[model samples]
Target: MVIAVRTKNTQTVSDYNCNGRHVFTQTRELERPLVGSILQSMWGVSPTHLTWSALHNSTLVDYSWSVGQTPFGPFSEMSTLSFAQKDAARRNVLLTSLNYSISSAIDVLDSVAAHGGERKLLKHNQYVEFVQRWSLFKYKLDKAVSALSHFDFELALYYLRSLDHDLYGAHAIVYHASQELEASLACFKDPPFPWATVSVYAVCVVAFIYVYMKRDKLFRNKRKQF
Candidate 1:
């Protein structure tokens, strides 16, 4: 037999109410597609490809798509996109996920003039570098999306996953965004190199050293005995 337990959050009714949430939330979501469209144009993709829903500001349209088959295999097309979509998707991902205003990129630059921690103040320049890298990835991802339009569903699907997880997930960023959203924020991951590789490399190196020493000892013993 088992007993169950439940507890309510400690906050009172007033604590649960928020006045500015909807305004901020909607504004935030709206910022994504709008900013995305800007990024798209910057990359030379036509503006029509980036479409938003009439019912809600959050839903974006995948208006561009084509389907045909070739040596690669049969394929059904889902969307048509451009480098701008890719860049916008990435920018949108950062803007939405991190609570960074559309101006976060600019804010980093402005921060240098305000002055605070010597280290912290100079760090914004590094941030500018990271934002540039993210933009580049988006540009590449859009190219991937456009190129994938020709193949059968299976192969095309594989290509999409390779580009971005959000592209496959239910919501799909409501815009074709890259999958590296989480990884993009950190800007880099230290190579822990993973356990399997470390174990394998370690074992191989150890084994090779042991064999070499054993052979040397055998030769020395034979020489001394002789």
Candidate 2:
């Protein structure tokens, strides 16, 4: 996720790379997150896509934003705006995208539960704990959305990233549950017969019968000679 932002003075965009991420003049710096999030969603690059596109195409919409222009929807509208409006637009883009991502992720978790496969797929304790953890995350997600709507980005960002540890736990629980399910399924599978052992026993029995028949014949001949 390397973003190189330069002013119109920069003719050769390819040659320049900066160590610090924030290279824009004061105005552009504030707009970076909003622009980045929308572009990431639209472009489907570096991270998850913002909007759905054709399976082969990375970008849902081909669009870019410029200074002093309202980057609204798929189309740009030229409008006059005070500094406050510009700030509001930036906040809206960032918070709205964050809300969408959180909702999508939570929906997947809920869908898994809705399938009624949790009992067969997950251990009793694991299923219970995962439900509890996801419930907590859902609560925080609601709080984060509320905070973002109220323009409290700092608190929203805090709550959004706070799911890191619980997310890891969720992943671990799912992995272990899948493994357990695989083992259980394997138990129901029929095992292959040991054909090699059976063949060896068959050969030994034939050889023993041959040897006994030969001995019996030899003894009859000896008795007839006597």
Candidate 3:
């Protein structure tokens, strides 16, 4: 994530009447990390090849010196100074906004994934649609990152802004499906009690108690046969 800028100076000299005149000029080169190479190694394709190569191989800043007694002059009066300042301000604002949007999107995604009973409650087609939407969301995020790598802030913002509808749709699908599932589960109630079976059991218990109490009188003549 670090950008390195290098400056090289070239000087010209001339001699006239025992006095020497010297002119110094500078050129700037930008060096970014070998991200494309790393990506190529990992994924077998270099997404940033053209952009990184163009940025690294081109001279970002070039300056020329006019013929004068003094080589250095006031920098505040430069014609492009105001434009550079404005560009920097705009870039800063865009970066801030992008950061907030990305974080919010991630939060939304996490909330959807963490919802309870999403798998059991959602139908096959609904789950499939959710998966497709998630894939699309991630693809857009990747494209936004690619745009950012090339410093295309506006394009990156556009991609980030477009994710809202998909995100909300996914959330609504899970929420409504879970609600329906809960409602269906709530419809089941316990069956009524078996009062007839309980009454038969009570009669059997009373008959057993009566026989136990009369057992001695019923066996009074049993010893006469011996």
Candidate 4:
């Protein structure tokens, strides 16, 4: 989701685009596993007015950090610093997150090979790993575009340098990110359902996995909060 961060620059407020993507960010950067479970639950949630409005109005809360533009409730407060102090820290955080996602996605996919998990039944923890990889794939694509919005080119480069680790999956991400950049002005003009599309899809995928694969074991267990 594109959160236009309007900063009070004296009398004139300037709008700066900050993409707040907390789920994938938490998973990759903060090493949070519950983030994936949260996405899964959001997808299958029985839609109600409270849930809908909460998701709709809850955009990125942090303006200074490298938060991707997301509609889901995953964002956190920016690092404890002023906006200017956050610029460099944000870039580093983005870079670290991209690296972590790429590495984690590759490992999870490799672990889930047909022969990898031979246990007859599905394990909740194991399924959580699957959710993360699926999420990592989509998020890598969406975040690539969001990174560009916040001048996170170095972070992009970091992801590119490691493309060899998973070239096949990386192709879709790299390709989509380019198309997204080309369409940025169009998105900036109207946003055109960027976060809504990605987050909704993420929510659905997670919910499906939780219900069909994990069978509510995930929800029954208390998840650690971000």
Encode model 2's per-residue lDDT on 59-83: one tens digit a residue.
5643333333443332222334435
Pairwise TM-score winner, candidates 1 and 4? 4
Tens digits of per-residue lDDT, candidate 3, 1-226, equal 4344454543223222222434222223121123323323432332211223364884333222211211122111122223333444456665665677567667756655565544765789988988877777778878877987787878977887776566667777776775665433456778889899999999999988988888776566565555
Report the backbone clash tally of model 2.
1
Off by over 4 Å in 4: 1-86, 114-137, 152-226
Model 1, span 1-226: residue lDDT tens: 2222333542222212224432111212233344334544443333443455777866564533312211110122223344444544454443342233224433433443344422333235534544454465455455444544442334433433443432222122211222322332546767775899889999999999998879978898999999
lDDT of 1 at 88: 42
Better model by TM-score, 2 or 4? 2
Query: Which residue runs of candidate 2 sit more than 4 Å off their true CA positions?
Result: 1-93, 96-100, 103-116, 183-226
- CA lDDT of each prediction against the hidden true structure: 0.40, 0.59, 0.54, 0.44
- Which is the better candidate, 1 or 3, if ranked by TM-score? 3
CA deviation > 4 Å runs, candidate 1: 1-122, 152-159, 165-226
Clashing pairs for predicted structure model 3, backbone only: none
lDDT of 4: 0.44
Clashes of 4: 13
